[model samples]
Target: MPGERIEGYATDPSALIERLFQQVAERSMVGLPFYRPQLPIKACAFQLLEGQLFGALLTPWMLQLMLLPGPGQRWDYRRADERLALAFPQGEILFRPGEIAPDLYYLSCSLLSPVDPALSAERAVALAENSVRLALSLPVRQTSVINTGRRALLRGALSANKG
Candidate 1:
């Protein structure tokens, strides 16, 4: 089976990285302290790693924004937090604190995508939650499939004696 490749396996390393990034976000957001409202978070920022790489080699900066309904008023994009202003261009409109349309309460997530051809759809949200969490120094739980050294050594010794 040398050189045999499995279908659906990402030949492109970028895709693997992207998938890992998404895993980080998915794991981080579940039962997350800031995730209670389930604000729409999106991947909107991208840093190019290489040019003309198959499927585009890019790293995305994932972000989420919360749009709290304005205090008895319509949404106002112009008044959104200045720090979040650059994340989403439409967010300037979608996340405005006022009413969505005078009666609806809604929020929007703006994202920087690594490979999303269509930018606005929720399906395009890239998973970079881990990068964000790491950058912010947020605590993360780690999991592994490999056995511990003690167990591995014991297993190796047992197999050697058996032979």
Candidate 2:
């Protein structure tokens, strides 16, 4: 059983991300000025779509949007750290690959990184979740022109314009 792998995503990814980053945080990031002790490590709001699993991962050093193959997709583990442009309903997001363990790989798009010390974990989590949800959503209206509001959304901030 130790060598066997489930068809797709058998283990909770939050646990995996937490464990992976926890090691990194403790090992290489302790004295870094950007590391936020209050931010902690967490993975939240993972969603599976069209055989890809994506979610928000928070560590003391950064927050990232993590993407992994769900069921039908397979990424060459050797391609770790290679950047790829992946198509989404919204647009193509650029992802850089990394490893969770031997033969296990994931992709990450940096979100809130070097997290603001003033930012509360609750707020960071909310923003991370919202950013993922918005990133995957199709634009309500297609336009060739890039407006400030839409640009902000594409840049990972929800539109502040309420109207």
Candidate 3:
């Protein structure tokens, strides 16, 4: 949740997509696909969490620009299966669609585990990179809808809980 902003990239959407994929491919192990509906603001962000977890924050348009299908559709993590599971090393990755907004989603990979102290930081970085790739490559379908305000409040509550 807390990370340094990835810098030195152009703001253009096309350029961002290229750079994002490149970064993820270089640093991660599996590439996973993800989907969501459109949102008011469009952006893509990457964060290195405590040097052990890598996170990618992508908007709906970003997914579309990446040539992935299903913008303006629904996504459900419950439907994800073993094939998706294999993309992540140590099976510690997470795919969380927004509960309130329903338009935002995150793919995160954990590098270090308190319970498994033997996990290496290098392995964690690779898994995180693979997650970004897998997110762009996977297929997702539209499912349901929720109010934007409700989504925002839900996100805020979740953030508060993390804090």
Candidate 4:
């Protein structure tokens, strides 16, 4: 049963991850106060980036960004839940080790914990897709200092940063 596909879905990049979380739900998440039966485990945008896999995940209990080592990549395993930093195109984010199988792990940055029961599955998936896209995009440009002050200062330089 270790590799059983959930809900008859074929293998995906996070299939191992999904099975791991499914085990967790079977063990302890079913009766949690905030656990909603309507919510299903989902993975979004799980594609390789610089030889690693990055994606967003939704479980009945939490929403997170996941980073998994791709083929031939091995991680320097860290203690589960210990804070670590992982960089995406957007920026560096705090992550923690997530154990998928014995000694096999992935990293995750939680976007939401103890997921709200009121959240609908469709909306949750949308949010996960958007989160993945945002995480992989370049960081938003900082506001120009000159724009915050006097406009006449534009004479200082032709461009915002140059001034």
Q: TM-score winner among the candidates?
A: 4
lDDT for position 163 in model 3: 89
Q: List residue ranges in candidate 2 displaced over 4 A.
A: 1-8, 142-163
For residues 15-92, could you state the per-residue lDDT of candidate 2 as single tens digits? 777787888788899889888888868887888877778888888788888887786554445355468898878799
lDDT of 4 by residue, 34-144 (tens): 787888888787887787778888999899998877756656656674798776787789988766556236678999887777889999989889999998888778765
Q: Model 2: what TM-score?
A: 0.74
TM-score of each: 0.21, 0.74, 0.21, 0.75
lDDT of the structure predicted as candidate 3: 0.34
lDDT of 1 by residue, 78-142 (tens): 33343333232112323332222322222334433223433333333333433323223434568
Q: Against the unseen true structure, what C-alpha lDDT does each candidate score?
A: 0.35, 0.76, 0.34, 0.76
Worst 10 residues of 4 by lDDT: 1-10
lDDT of 2 at 111: 79
**Deviation (Å) of 33 in candidate 1:** 38
Instruction: Supply every candidate's count of residue pairs whose N, Cα or C atoms clash at under 3 angstroms.
Output: 10, 0, 20, 0
Output the lDDT of residue 53, model 1.
Answer: 15
